[model samples]
Target: MGVMNELIDPPGIGTLTRILTESAPMVEWKQTAATASLLGDLNLRARTDLVADALVADISTGPVPGYTTASASFRAALAAPKFTGWVLWPVSEAAVTLALASDAAEDFNDCLALLAELTPRLTGEFAVRRLLARDMDRALAAILTWTAHPDEHVRRLASEGTRPYLPWAVRVPALVRRPEATLPILTALYRDPSEYVRRSVANHLNDLARHAPDAVVDTARHWLAAADRNTGWVVRHGLRTLIKKGHPGALALFGFPPASVAVSGPRLDQEILTVPGELTFAFEISNTGTRDVRLAVDYLIHYRKANGSQSAKVFKISTLTLAPGESRSISKRHAFRQMTTRVHHPGLHALELQINGAAHGRTEFVLEMA
Candidate 1:
């Protein structure tokens, strides 16, 4: 994410300004003023908005509506050969911002079409989110048709743009609340020939599992009923979140039915995990059930939160099948590295094993700040 922010750095904006100047006759976009205040760690969204704000401000200066003026300016900018890549992110954003200002169905629909055009250059996923928020039903109606569109990028946008929990994109409350809103789109593209499109569809379905597990499972089941060579892969990816959370239906979908098992120690190399150190742990599980049982094995880490509370996070370990009386040893080495996403605090912690949607043994350990 940090590296992506650098893609639209100061020099990149200069290039954007140069392209705008050379591309469109009416686009006299001077990004000089916009670049001045963009000092420091102005995250990716901030950089995109800064540039879009400049475009909207410049193009809408005349009597024309911002949407009308900006849309035309951006459409003209597209004629340039180099008018692609990360620069289009702001352009797509600016187009949507202005189009929504008109509040006319014509402009809103045009904005959707514009995003379809721009998606091939760089994803208009970030920009189209606001449109979905504004008029979900109307936008989704248009997006549904995109699932069958010949262009792979447009098909991908149909699924990717409507994800309920699309990361780095603004939340659409209606979509999150009514998770079924985008199922038709997902259903259509689940078996898409393009891996890119299929990936987005799986992720879109996975997002649904976060809030609407039953619906997600049902959808996966429906897809599985009409199975293809790629259906299993798509369903597996779609159920990833549910699988990680040890959801029974998800585990069952992959034929990992619950079974009786005897678990041994999750013994650690050291009882105390020092900062900038490694923790190696191993455990063994035996299939005590009479029939062979498939397992989805995972490990859980209960880390001490900053406020002295503990939060359990699950990590994927491995998956296997064991016959009755069969046993297997699971071992892993976890590094306690300082990361931007998680801040580690020193205190009591624990490790546990999760097999077949059930947690087995837990071993306590201490975290020390070195």
Candidate 2:
């Protein structure tokens, strides 16, 4: 079975339906159960949609008066021990959908309250997007408040909800256009005590870096001025993409000086290989400058795609300090394994060495199917 099916299978949905009935006698369990029974034939997204639609229909038809009342009962139902972990994800999705529907008509305060209460159990990050689209300032206000909330999950929501490129969630164009709006929220949680919150803060800043590198670099400089270990971790993670790109500011932040190195002796173990095989290579790095320098060593493989085009993937090798006239030998083995996400085609592949973002020492190998 696929991952989504495993997460919310038939048995789990049945249990969730039963819990709803027990928590709110006013709900028409018969209809909800019937809807859930048909979910087995649907894909993961479809199943989520069907379950949510059924619940909304049942709540609208049953004795529950309005969106707020129905949301309250659903939140209470989810409190049962059985609805823990990923199983509650679908329920949260459904509840958030309902809240968004109500929020569209200007009945949002109750929905926001429901999300704050429900997010600790399951994320309301997806639902919060509707608010952002309808009214950005209002959403920003709510998100800023969440950054200070006692619950780590809610504080995380503040960052996760505002991410310009949040996976599986709709993009916020305003934030994409003006990423600075997020600076307030990020600054508020810069030194958040919870690792969970700090990680989300890093991811949010990373998204911003893609659009506004200078802004992110400036923020990194400010955050690094008096950073604790945890806050420093966030800055490092936030600067990963910039570091990979060899941005001078990002490299300087990590103490990697200008590139003053020599690369030589590039060798590939095999000139030809097959799928499910390994490609090993080695090279040497020598410091050619007058002073010691920190080197961030990385390599890139220009993979030939099935379309006869090439794409590059960067891999980190190691980081070390090299004094003048010092040299070090480094080696790496890359396995060309078949993966569900990628299809391999017979073609020529090239590898290159990178030191602090400067490229050198190129070599090539051929790949074929067995």
Candidate 3:
């Protein structure tokens, strides 16, 4: 199995079963073991399903009063040594699913309480999604309070959980329509001392940028006014998509002035390449106008796909300021190695240079199989 698969594979299930059994000694170990064994024949989705199944089996057979009581019992059992970090992901997810199944508001409250302790172990981000769907106002109010919590993980959950487009989780339509609802949470944590929290805030803002560009640009301007190094980093990172698209407002906010530059010397070191080969290219940019100019330089490679089509992927080269009459040379070497993520087919590939989002220089090269 690959490194990623190992995290949720059989060993991970075994560890979770052992911890659960130890945490709640009253749990039916025999039933839990049987459920775990059944997980081996299942794929990823089946494995997660089995985790919930095992939790249900344990709860039914073990001494449990209700969902809230069961939640508390399981949580109490998950003390130190056994449950911690990414290794506990399967267990955490199972617990969250079980908690969400409860119909009682009190049960959800209990789950939220458990998540505060469990989030640092894995993440309560996914768990909170159900709460938001259940009651947006209530969930947002609680999450807003969490933003101020002493624990950076809880603070991060406040932002991460409310993301309009959180990956691997269902989209929050309310947030998608009214992203401003999250501004208060973002405002509280934009300059958070923890890089972990700040990164989440940046990502949250990036997600908002997708549907609410104007709002995001406004926020960027507001944040940039008194940005410390860390806050500035968040603003820049948050504006990555806008930067790539060469949004004039975003560029202007970053002081990347209008295009008063000239680009030349678009050439490839080789016209033909084989698998596992290296392609070297160089270009130069000069500030022809009588003023300093901030520039965002990037290059795109149109890779040949197996189905005789091309897809372009952009890569950043540099971001800099150039004085009047100043020129700079940029060079890059890209490997054409076979990657599991992408299949490279032999064909003519196009290379283009983008300055402030406009394609200025172009070249082509041939890629062949070894």
- The 10-residue segment of model 1 with minimum total lDDT is 24-33
The runs of at least 3 residues in candidate 2 whose Cα sits more than 4 Å from the true structure, single-residue gaps closed, are 1-30, 62-68, 71-106, 164-180, 207-214, 241-247, 265-284, 327-343, 363-370
Q: Summarize candidate 3's per-residue lDDT along 1-370 as a digit string, tens digits.
A: 3444445565666776677666767666565566555655455544655665666666756666346545655576567565665444445555656667766666666666777777877787875787788778877877788888898998898889899989867667888888788988998899898999999999999999888887898988988886777987898889889887776778778777567888986789999998889999999999998878878888889898878889988888889889999999999988888888877899989899888777878898999999
* lDDT comparing candidate 2 with the true structure: 0.80
For each candidate, what is the lDDT?
Answer: 0.86, 0.80, 0.77
Clashing pairs in 3: none
Model 1, span 47-127: residue lDDT tens: 888888887876776456467666666666677677778867888998998888886669999899989988888999989
Query: Model 2 TM-score?
Result: 0.79
Residue-pair clashes per prediction, in order, are: 1, 0, 0
lDDT of 1 at 349: 91
Models ranked on lDDT: 1, 2, 3
Clashes in candidate 1: how many?
A: 1
The CA root-mean-square deviation of candidate 1, after full C-alpha superposition on the true structure, stands at 3.9
User: What lDDT score is found at residue 175 in candidate 3?
Assistant: 84
What's the best-to-worst order under TM-score? Answer: 1, 2, 3
